[model samples]
Structure formats: C-alpha cells, structure tokens
Target: MTFQWDAIWGALPVLLEGAKLTLWISILGLLGGVVIGLVAGFARAYGGFFSNRLALVFIELIRGTPIMVQVMFIYFALPLMVPVRIDPFGAAVVTIMINSGAYIAEITRGAVLSINRGFREAGLALGLSGRDTLRYVIAPLAFRRMIPALGNQWIVSIKDTSLFIVIGVAELTRQGQEVIAGNFRAMEVWTAVAVIYLIITLALSYTLRRIEGRLKIL
Candidate 1:
C-alpha cells in the first residue's frame, strides 16, 4: 500500500490529546512511585527484620506478576470485593505507580546498600540520629547514584501507559486504534503513533541525561 505522508499530520491532533493523558498518567505515577520506592527502600535497608521481610514480599509480588493483571484486578476485581471503584484513568495511573515502585525500590535499595558504611558511622559520630544521617547524607547520595536506573524506569513507565488501552483508558495506543478504525489507514495511523512515541522517549532520554550530568557535577 502506498503511504500518505499527510495522513500522519492529520492524525497529530487526535494523537496529542491521547498523549496528554499518557503524560498525565506517567508523571503522577512516577511521582508516587518515587516516594514509595524511597520509603520501602529505606525499610529494606534499615527497618530491621520484619519490616525488611515485608518490603521484600511486597516488591517480589509486584515484580513477579504481569502489570495488566494487576490493573485488571484493581479496576474490575477489586470493585467486586470491596466498596471501591476506580475508573480506567485512576486504575491506569495506580497500576503504573505500583509497578514502577517495585523496580524503583530495588534500585533505591541497591544504591543505598552500595554506599560505604563509614559514611553512616561518620554521621552518627557527628551527633546525628540515624534518620538525620540518612536524610542529610546517605539518601541524597543514593538518589544521585540511582539516576540512570530511575531514568530507565521513567521511560518504561511512559511506554507502559499504552497497556492501559486494554482497560479503555484512551491513551496514545487507543487513540491510534480509534483513528485507524475510522479511516482504515492502519499503516499511516500506526506509523504516526510509533513516531510520536519515539519522539517522546527521545526527548525524555535527552532530559534525563542532562539531569544525570548535572548531578554528577554536584
């Protein structure tokens, strides 16, 4: 089939609307995920026996399962079991947050554990509480160290928004499908969608590298 270049331009507006939601879901999810990861990571690193074990179980359960299944359970199954009903957008964002938190926790934990014990000892020697030592010293260093892993997860989280289409969140991929259905221009619509995603990812990669470089200088 002959491809029409203009058809891509025609689809941009529709796709951008969908992409907005994609960004919304990704940003909110990542924000929440970072908080969860940091807290859980700290627990695993220093919360002692039971807290560490609990964090490990939560992370493992999330990482081991498919994200789609998780979203489905939250959106469909949970309502059946409890007085809860999350719309597709809420479900999608929550799913990404949960999924991203698991991986981010592992990344945070690894970064924290890799730090020299002497640093913590020094902070303690300075009359600082363990919490203060972590907050004022180790946490900052570990976050800087984990920049690459967090950036990687940021991209993964963005791309994963496409999966929310299965639950009818009307994200980028779903928008493309709707356009294709109306026009029957599968190649053009899908190609445009793919290009849009590539652009977003590339822009994100560039921004992340800039942040990473800035952190390295600090």
Candidate 2:
C-alpha cells in the first residue's frame, strides 16, 4: 500500500534512458559475442590440433567461472595485469561479449557436430576444398540450427547488463536503485523496472521464436 504511483511516473523518463543504454550495450555485446562464437566454433570444428585446443580452452575457462567474477576481474583486476584500465561501460560490454561467446561457442560446436557426416563427405567428394566444404555444406545447416540457441544467449546477455551496475554503470537496474534511494519508494521503483525488463524480454522472445519457426529445417 506504500507504493507511490507519482514517484514511478516521475522516475520513468530517466529509467527509460537507462533502458535504452542497456539495450545498446546488450546489442553491441552480443554482436561481438556472435563473431567470437563463429570464429571459435570454426576453430574447434576444423582447425589444427593446437588451434582447436586453444579454442576449447577459451570456451571452457569462460564457461567455468561466474560472470560476476569475470566482470570484476576485467574492471578492477585488469589494470594490474595489463597497462590500461577499462572504463565501466567497456568492462560491461567485454564481460557480456566474452560470457555470451563461451556459451554460443559450445552451442555452435554442438550444432556443427550434430550434422550428419554424410553432408561433409559428400561436399569433399564433390571436389570442394575443405574451406568450401565448410562454407557450403557445414556452416549453412549449422547456423540455421543455431538460431534458437543464439536467441537464448542473446536474452542472457541482455539480462547480464544489470550486473554491470556493480561497477557503477547506470543501467536500468541501477537507475531504478537510484530512484528508490532518493525517494524511498523501493516497491514502486523496482516494480516499474521489473515490468520494463519483462516487456522487452518477452518481446525479444516472441521475435526470436518467430525467426526460429521460419528457419526450422522443414
């Protein structure tokens, strides 16, 4: 009963700004993640032994750790390890990119490997080079199958932006926190924030599902 509707309204515009920033970060982060996933997935699929091992190690190491720890390391500990300190936004994007990449790499590898070997053999039998075989035969089918998994990872990446607030980036959750801290209307602020996230996530899910359905191997 203590919820103040007026406070929620007053905070709406700034929270919307925060939401836009969150979306920007998530999109850019996932784009980077997709590139990394594709490269690492290919390396695992067709690279020489050393390259394959390296790719596998990268995927495993990222997957094994909590993302919060990874983000903190990149933001706080990276300066000690390297010459430059990463800003909060950069750290958040890097965290999302790498974290999303690891999972997507695993998904990509699975999708690639799950394809029947006959398709690959047939491509080779047709005088296609190894590269051509992958491009024409393996990659097309594998990526088509990868849509759903990629969409799920995209959702995770979007949610992960909330964690960046720990480093002081004013994402949607952070903005909501600031509102509550100022107005002492935790219920109203948090409820508004939760609904905003839910709306976007549900919309993303719907869109992805439509794409998935259209792209299904039928």
Candidate 3:
C-alpha cells in the first residue's frame, strides 16, 4: 500500500502533544536518576558497610526487574500501598527515574572506580577531606567519563517512555495508537510514529555529541 501523507499530517498535532509529555518525563526522570545515581555511586565507592549494602540492594532491585513491570507497579500497585496517589505521568516519570538510576549508578560506580588510586591519595595528601576530594576532584572527572554512558541512558529512557501508554499517558506511541484507531491506518500511523521517534533520537544524539565535545575541551 501507498504511504498516506494525509493520515500522518492529521496525526502530527496529537503526536506533538505526546512528544512534549515524553520530553518532560525524560528530562525530569533523567534529573532524578542522576541524583540517585550519584548518591548510590558515592555510597558504593566510599560509604562503609551499611551504605554499600543499601546501594547494592537498590541497584539490584531496579536492574533486575522489567521496566514495564516497574511502571505497572508504580501506577497500579503503589497506590494500594500508599496514601499518596500518583497520576500516570507522575508514575511514568518515577519509573524512569528508578530504572535509569540503577543503570546510571553502575556507570557512575565504574567511572569513579576506574580513576587511578593515586588521585585519591594525592587528594588526601593535599589535605582535602573525603567529601571535598570526591566533590572537587573525583566527581568532576568521573562525570566526564560518564557522559557517553549517560547519553545512552537518556536515549533508552526516552524510548522507554512509550511504555507509559499502558497507564494512559499520552506519549507518542499512545498518540499513534489513537490515530490508527480513528483512521484504521495502522501502517501509516506507525511509520509516522517511527519517523518522529527517529528524528527526536537523532536530534538528541547530535546535541549530546556537541556537549561531549565541549566537555572534552574543558
């Protein structure tokens, strides 16, 4: 069958709204994930027994589960357990944060550990406190090393946001489904959706490449 430009054009605005929600979810999730990752990474790197065990448990729990299950649990199961109810969008963001956090923690931990032991010794010799050394010396270098991995996580998180459609969040996949339902044009709608996703992913990769280049120069 021929490609249907009209169907795609008609679906654009609806998909745009979904795209915006996806972007918001990804950005907020990435921010939360980075914070959790940094904390977990530090714990694994420097914290004593209790902190190390806790971080290990968290990372394992998140990484071991399917993200779809995590999203479903946050959206469906958590409300039954807690007084606070999160909407689909909030749930999606939270799941992304938790999922990405696990992966990012690994990245951070690896990056920090890969730094030469001499750096830590040098920091101590320079009279820097453990926290100060991590903040000033270790973290900066570790974060630079983490850029490429983090970029990959960001891309994965963005794609994963499509899973939020199960909870009724109007992300691109859900928008495409709606359009297909209305027009009975599944092939056309899905193709358009794929192209949109490709465009967004390419743009994001390009932007991150520029950022990586700048960071390398600094």
Candidate 4:
C-alpha cells in the first residue's frame, strides 16, 4: 500500500489540538503527583507511626491496582460516594495524579534511603535539627540521585495520559480514534498517531537525559 502524506498532514491540526490537552493533563497531573509524593515520601522517611502507616496504605492501594480500574473508579464511583461531581477531564487528571503519585512516592523514598547515613549523622553532630538537616543536606543529594528515576516517571505519566481516552477526554489517542472513524483508514491514522506519540516521548526523554547529566555534575 502507498503511504498517504496528505492524510497525515490533514490530521495534524486536529492532533496538535489534542496534543495540547494531553500536555495540560500531564503537566497538572505531574504537579499534583509531585506534591503528594513529596509529602508521602518525607512521611515514610521521617514522620511518626500514624503518618508512615497512612502513606504505606496509600502506596499499597495505588500500586496494587490497575490504572484503568482506578480511572474508572474515580470517574464512576467517586460521585456516588461524595456530593461533588467531576467532569471527564477533571476525573482523568485526578486519576493520573493519584496513580502517578504512588509510584513517585516509592521513587522518592528509595532515593532518600539510598543517601549515605553518614551525612545525616554529620548534620546531626553539627547541631542541625532533623528537619533542617534534611532540608539543607539530605534532600539536595537525594533529589540529585532521584533525577534518573524521576525522568522515567515523567515519561510514564505522559504515556499514561492515553488512558484518559476511556473517559472521553480529547487527548492524542482519542483524537486518533476519531480521525480513524471518520476516514475509515485505521492503518494510516494509527500509524500517524504512533509516530506522534513516539516523537513526543523521544523529545521528552532527550530533554530529561540532558537535565540528568547536569544534575550529576553538581
């Protein structure tokens, strides 16, 4: 079969608009995930019994479940449980945030734990409080070490945005589906979608690698 450049070009504008929504969801989700991960990570690393247990439960719950199931639950079950109503886009974003946060929390915990104990001891000997020591000494080193893992998470989160398609969010994959339905050219439409996703993912990976290299030098 011959390649169809015109078809691909015709789909670009629609895909680009969908890509924007994908980006927005990923960005907001990553932000939310980071906040939750930071708190949960710190709690597991340093907080007392109640906090640690809560974090543990959260991590287990999210990590054990499928992300698709989580998304469906959030979109379908949440409204039944609570008075608030979340639209498809909002539900999808919330799902991404909660799902990604669990993995990120583990990443953060592992990074912090991998830091040398000697640094903590030295900081304590130098009269820094526990919080201050972590803030000034531990967190910096841990964050640097975590860059590679965090980069992996960022890519995962971006791809995970595709799951939002189930909820009727007009993300990249959803747009591709719509285009394919209209033209009845599944091969051309899907190939274009795959290429687009690959391009975005590769670009993100390249940028993250550069950032990781810079962090290593510090």
Candidate 5:
C-alpha cells in the first residue's frame, strides 16, 4: 500500500498537542522526582539507621514495580483504599515522579558517594557544620556528576509518558491511536508518532550534551 502522506500531515496538529502534554507532564514529574531523589539519596548516603532503612525500602519498592502497574494502582486501586481518586493525568504525573525518583535516587547516591571522603572532612575542619558542608561542598560536586545520569532519567521519563495511553491521558501514543482509529491510517499515524518522539528525544540529548560540556568547564 502506498504510504499516506496526507494522513500524517492531517494528524500533525493533534500529535503535536499530545506531544506538548507529554513534555509538560514529563517536566513537572521529573522536577518533583529530582526533589524526591535528593532527599532519598541523602538519607541512603548519610542518614542514621532508620532513615536509611526507610529510604531503602522506598527506593526498592518503587524500582521493583512496573510504572504501568504503579499508575494503574494510583488511578484505579487507590480510590478503593483511601479517600483519594486521581484522574488519569494526575496519575500519570505521579507515577512518573515516583518511578523516575527511584532510579534517580540511585544515581544520586552513587554520585555523592564517589566523591572523596577527604573533601567532606576538610569542610568539617573548616568549621562548616554537617548540613552546611553537605550543602556548600558535597552537593555541588556530586550534582556535576549527576548530570549525565539525570539526563538519561529525564529522557526515559519522557518516553515513559507514552505508556499513559493505557490510562487515557491523551499523550502522543494515544493521539496516534485516535488518529489511526478515525482514519484507518495506522502506518502513517504511527510513523508520525515515532518521528515526533525521536525529534523530542534527540533534541533533549543535544541540549543535555551542551549542558554537560559547560559543566565540565566549571
């Protein structure tokens, strides 16, 4: 069968809208993931026994599960157990935050631990309190090391947004499915959808590369 150029052209607007929502939710979710990762990472790295154990359980539980199951549980199961009912969009964002946070926490822990112990000791000797030393000395250096792993997680989280089609979030994959449903142009719609994802991920990779270069200089 001849490829349907017209179907792709016609579906561009809807696909772009879906792509926008994908990017939006990814950014929001990964931002929150970064915050969650930082706390969990530090707890695992430096906190006392209970805090470390708690963070370990959280990280392990999240990392052990599939994101689809997590989102499904949030959207469909949680309402049965609690006074909370998250809509599809909210569920998608929450799941990405949690799923990515687990991985990011591991990345953060590795980066922080890779730094020499002497730097930390030196900071303490210079009259910096433990909190101040962590903030002013350790965090900046570890963050530099985190750039690549964090970039990877960001890209993974963005692609993971497509899975939200299972929950009907109208993200890029769902838009492609809808377009194909209306026009019976699965080949064209799916090709357009894939190219859009490639464009976004490639652009993200390029931007992260530039940022990594600049950070290396500092």
Candidate 6:
C-alpha cells in the first residue's frame, strides 16, 4: 500500500494530544517514583533490619510482577476488593510509579553502596552528622552514578505507557489505533506513532546525556 501523507497529516493532531497525555502521566508517575525510590533505596542501603526488610519486600514484589498485571489490578481488581474505583489515567500513573520505583530503588541502593565507605567516614570525621554526611557527601556521588540507570528506567516507563491501551487510557498508541480505525490507514498511522515515540525517547536520551556530562564525578 502506498503511504498516505494525507492520513499522516490528519492523524497528527489526535496523536499529538495522545502524546501529551502520555507525557503527562509519565512525568507525574516518574516524579512520584523518584520520591519512592529515594526513600526505599536509602532504607535498603542503610536502614536497620525491619526497614530494610520492608523495602526489600516492596521492591521484590513489584519487580516480580508484570506491569500490565499491575495496571489491571489497580484499575479492575482493586475496585472489587476495595470501596474505591480508579480511572484509567490514575491507574496508568500509579502502575508506572510502583513498577518504575521498584527498579529505581535497586538502582539507588546499588549506586549508594558502590560509593567508598571512606567518604562517609571522612565526612563524619569532619564533624558532619550522619544525616548531613549522607545528604552532602554520599548523595552527590551516588546520584551521578544513578543518572544512566534512572534515564533508562524513565525511557522504558514512557514506552510502557502504550500498554495502558488495554484499559483504554487514550495514550499515543491507543490514539494511533483509533485514527487507523476511522481512516483504515494502519500503515501510515502506526508509522507516525512509532516516529513520535522514537523522537520522544531520543530527546530524553539527549537531555539525560547532557545532565550526565555536567555532573560527571571523575
């Protein structure tokens, strides 16, 4: 079939709206994930027994399950069990937060642990409190190491927004499918959709690389 530029032009607006929704959910989700990951990561890396165990359970459980299942459980099953219902957008954002946070927690823990213990000791010897040492000395170094892994997770989470189509969040892929349904131009519409996703990921990667360059520790 000849590619239809007309179909591409017609679908661009709808697809861009979908892309905006996709970015909205991903940004909100990832921001929450960063908060969760930092707390959980610090717990796993340095907390006492109970806190470490709790963080470990959370990280392991979320990482073990598929994100699609997580989304379905939030949007479908949770309503059955609880007295509340969640919309598709809420479910999508929550699932991304939980799923991405698990991986990010591990990334955080590893980065923190990888730093030399002598740095912490030196900070303490310089009369810094443990909390201040962590905040000032350890965090800076660890965050530099975390940049690449965190970037990968962010990119993956953005692409994974496509799976929300199962519950009908109207993200980019779902919008593309809808456009194709109306015009019967799957080839053109899907090509445009893929290009949009590629562009988003590439832009994210470039931004991350620039941040990494500015923060290079060594």
Best by lDDT: 6
- lDDT for each of the candidates? 0.91, 0.91, 0.91, 0.88, 0.93, 0.95
Ranking by TM-score: 5, 6, 1, 3, 4, 2
- For model 3, the stretches where C-alpha displacement exceeds 4 angstroms are none
Which of the predicted structures, 3 or 5, would earn the higher TM-score when compared with the native? 5
Name model 1 segments beyond 4 Å from true. Answer: none
Writing each residue's lDDT as its tens digit, candidate 6 over 1-218 gives 79889999999999999999999999999989988999999999999999999999999999999999999999999999999999999999999999989988999999999999999999999999999999999998999999999999999999999999999999999999999899999999999999999999999999999999999885
lDDT of 6 at 68: 94
| Tens digits of per-residue lDDT for model 4, 1-218 | 78787888888899888888988888888889988998899899888999999999999999999989998998889889999889989987898889888988998899889888999999999999989999999999998888888778878887888888888999999999999888777778888888888898899889988998888833
User: Candidate 4: which stretches are off by over 4 Å?
Assistant: none
List clashing residue pairs in candidate 4. none
- On a 0 to 100 scale, what is the lDDT of residue 114 in model 3? 87
Query: Can you give the TM-score per candidate against the true fold?
Result: 0.97, 0.95, 0.96, 0.96, 0.98, 0.98
Clashing pairs in 1: none
Error of 4 at 20 (Å): 1.6
Model 3 per-residue lDDT at 191: 86
Candidate 2 runs further than 4 Å off: none
Candidate 2, 35-139: lDDT as tens digits: 899889888987889989999999999999999999999999999989998999999999999999888888888999989999999999999998999999999
- Judged by lDDT against the true structure, how good is candidate 5? 0.93
